[model samples]
Target: MGRTALIVIDMLNTYEHEDAQVLVRSVREALPGVKTLLERARAADAPVIYVNDNFGRWRSHHGEILEAALAGPRADLVEPIAPDEESLFVVKARHSAFYETPLAYLLGRLGAERVVLCGQVTEQCVLYSALDAHIRHLDVVVALDAVAHIDADLADAALLMMERNMAAELRPNGDITFGDARSD
Candidate 1:
């Protein structure tokens, strides 16, 4: 039996990128699910790790990155799922959270053998992160309704790949449960 961690990826964003409008639209639909997962994870006392993109702000830390997102026009989206004091933060410069990041070591330290992934860019970040986690032999779960995507078709294909190719479980946020490792 092993612990489970909720990995909220790249939800803190300024929505100032090339396809941000499309991404924001999907995110709006997915927001409630993401919020629900956050609450459930918190209530269960499971580790909630926020693995966010640094947005090329080399000097920025978690606080600074969060501040920038909250100050952006799309702050509403970030507000509901903002990382609390109990949430762990990891800044990543690449698509995969584990790439050049301490996420693997952190997960090991926390004894998290399973991870539930939620957040933006289903076709990109989420896809890559799932593959990385799969190779590392971590059980991966992707919350379908809790993830936003830029392209619908690509996102669909990505989810299939995560499920069939990577063996990542695909479930809606409502079905996800968190807590003790043995019970999970």
Candidate 2:
């Protein structure tokens, strides 16, 4: 099998605030699992790509994420972590990373055929990425604990949907590491 890539969508700290944090949605609960995957990917030298939502501002997403994170009392909150010099950062304007983004080319260049999709608003961005992965015929898996949304019930529903309909295996965070080549 080809090497794998871990795509983390919209896991930045900017969305962690209460107001902008989506009262009915959040990925905070998934942070631990997401972090675990990141650490493992880093250790294994696997490509860990941050597929950030440009949020429609074509010119200033980097600043927008920062401004959103630092506005008002949120300034005291942790800054949205910058993509490390080592990791790849792909800013996306739309829901799917494969749309209007070089993500596909990047993956091709990386020689990765398997992808682990994880991140916030499991019903939204995460859902879109999984579907896109399936459409693209890439081997896709959605990390279970590595996803979050404010509505716990809805989040669970989304997970079930992905499992049954999308063929996305839900692996609980901490139960597995990414460096392992086995799909399980």
Candidate 3:
């Protein structure tokens, strides 16, 4: 069987943008579920890849990004889900994790045939990343409760599209089992 990886996208946010408050609230609501999923993935020894937006800092490294987020207003969100030493980090310039990022190559290197997407902005980054993953012929799974969004209606629509168009599996965090049981 192929390997599985958990893609945590845009969770290291500063919450300083236009709709930051809304997004932060949603993220906070989803924290418990996301945390549980993280623990399960780690325990299963599944690869945890953090895909974050560079926030226009072309030269910023992961350390710098972590520092900025930790010092910012949304530190609660960033701190709880901070990438550990064993976790992989990828900086993306766009909504999709695969867009101008090394995510695809990294997944390939890890022999990741399936990816569990969890994080913020469900309608944007998660949706786009799912699309890209579909195009790459990778099995996509979205943790419904582990992802937060700025708009509820749009996020629901996006999830529906992913299910119908991309055949992405939508399941709650509790239902997700990493490693050998992932394919089921």
Candidate 4:
């Protein structure tokens, strides 16, 4: 467990597109893998950062976001749940969490030489964060089934985009065991 962090990007119950129901539906498939990764990071004392979008606004708070999401139209479909106090949450106003955010400095302080990104639509938030990691020269690995999009093509393109264009590699859950050393 070298200097690494697990970045769970935009998994908030908000911005639950693809018909809010699709959020849990899509995440249901990936949650286990993401959870496993999180657990390992916790045991290894690695950082776990939850990067979320400000959803088109600058002055946004996590509490406000959750309240609006619950009172919003998709309340039934979108379930806004809060994380335990131990986790770190980063609110961003753009696609990339690193854009005008303290993510870079936080990771630097954590001595994170690598970032494992997962969450939301692979076509959007996930892609941006991964590229930012690449630009910072941080190692990146994404789980294949752990990400998705309403438009299959967009998701496929996003995944392929990273693998071909940004040098991101896919780490399947089946091949990885929690607490196992990350050889890459």
Candidate 5:
């Protein structure tokens, strides 16, 4: 059993895009599960990493991003899952959290061998991050109910690909536990 960390990807979203409504709906459905996972992870003393998109704003910081997101149409989604003071925050320019980001180095520094992924765009960011983690030889576990997708069918395909090709575990939020009591 290795050290574990929880990666919350791209949840601090503005949700002002064309498909924002669709994405928000799915995120809303997953919010409860995500929240529960967060609480459990904290209780287990696992590190919480928040990998967020910069939204093409190279000069933007985390506070700015949070402010913009909370003031946007889907504040409901971003507000409830706001990162706490102890959480690690990383900004990424691409879909994959490791692409052009310090996520891999950060995870290594934290001594995290197993990563549990949770957040938005299941078929996009979450999927790409999972692939990147797999290539890094890190054990991956994706919280099935904690991820949101714009397209249900595409998300399902992505989940299957992750499970088959990357040997990633796809489990629901209730089944995930960290530290000594972790089942992964």
Candidate 6:
């Protein structure tokens, strides 16, 4: 086995969208698990990557994106898992983190053969990203409790699809492992 990375997807949100109410509820529940994974990954010296949507901000970078999310109405939600200086960030324009982004290349460079996924929109971004990662031959593990969703039904179905079709390992955040000294 090579290295493993923790990929946090679309957690930096303004929550100013159509499904904000529903999504916010799920986010609140997932927050603690996401925080735990972030701490564990950092402590073990494992790669922590924040692959976030750019919100169509063509010129904005990660810092600007983070600032905007923090300044939003739901700053409380964004603050807890905000990226640290050591966290690698990839600004994505689409649902899948691997879509038109440098994420695949970055993973390659980091020697990360396996990726542990967490963060929001389980039925959307998280599901799509997992498929992309699977097709790219990278092992994928989704932290179930650490992912928020807009629709519970769809989220459940997505999880089943990821495990049944994509062969993704679906596990709770606490059960996730970074391997070697990083194992927890």
Per-candidate TM-score against the hidden true structure:
0.98, 0.81, 0.97, 0.80, 0.96, 0.97
Off by over 4 Å in 4: 15-24, 56-58, 66-82, 174-184
Predictions in order: lDDT: 0.95, 0.70, 0.91, 0.71, 0.90, 0.93
Clashes of each: 0, 3, 0, 0, 0, 0
By lDDT: ranked, best first: 1, 6, 3, 5, 4, 2
Superposed model 1: Cα runs more than 4 Å off: none
- In model 2, residue pairs whose N, Cα or C atoms come closer than 3 Å (at least 3 residues apart or on different chains), thus clashing, are 25-150, 26-149, 26-150
Candidate 1: count the clashes: 0
* Residues 124-168 of candidate 4: C-alpha lDDT, one tens digit per residue: 888898898889887778877666555568878888889887898
Stretches of candidate 6 exceeding 4 Å from the true structure: 180-184
lDDT of 2 by residue, 1-184 (tens): 6778889887654444454556313444566677778787778788888888765666865556656645644343223333455778788877777878888889889888778887776777788888777777777778887776766687788778877877877887565555645654
Cα displacement (angstroms), candidate 6, residue 117, comes to 0.6
TM-score of model 1 relative to the true fold? Answer: 0.98
- Poorest lDDT segment (10 consecutive residues) of candidate 1: 175-184
Candidate whose TM-score is highest? 1
Please state the error at residue 157 of candidate 5 in Å: 0.2
Residue-level lDDT tens digits of model 1 in 25-121: 9999999999999999999999999999999999999999999999998999999999999999999999998999999999999999999999989
**Tens digit of lDDT per residue, candidate 3, span 67-182?**
99999987878878888899999999999999988899999999998999999889999999999999999999999999999999999999999999999999999988887634
Best by lDDT: 1
TM-score, predicted candidate 4 vs. hidden true structure: 0.80
RMSD of 2: 3.2
Superior candidate under lDDT, 2 versus 4 = 4
Model 2 CA lDDT for position 140: 78
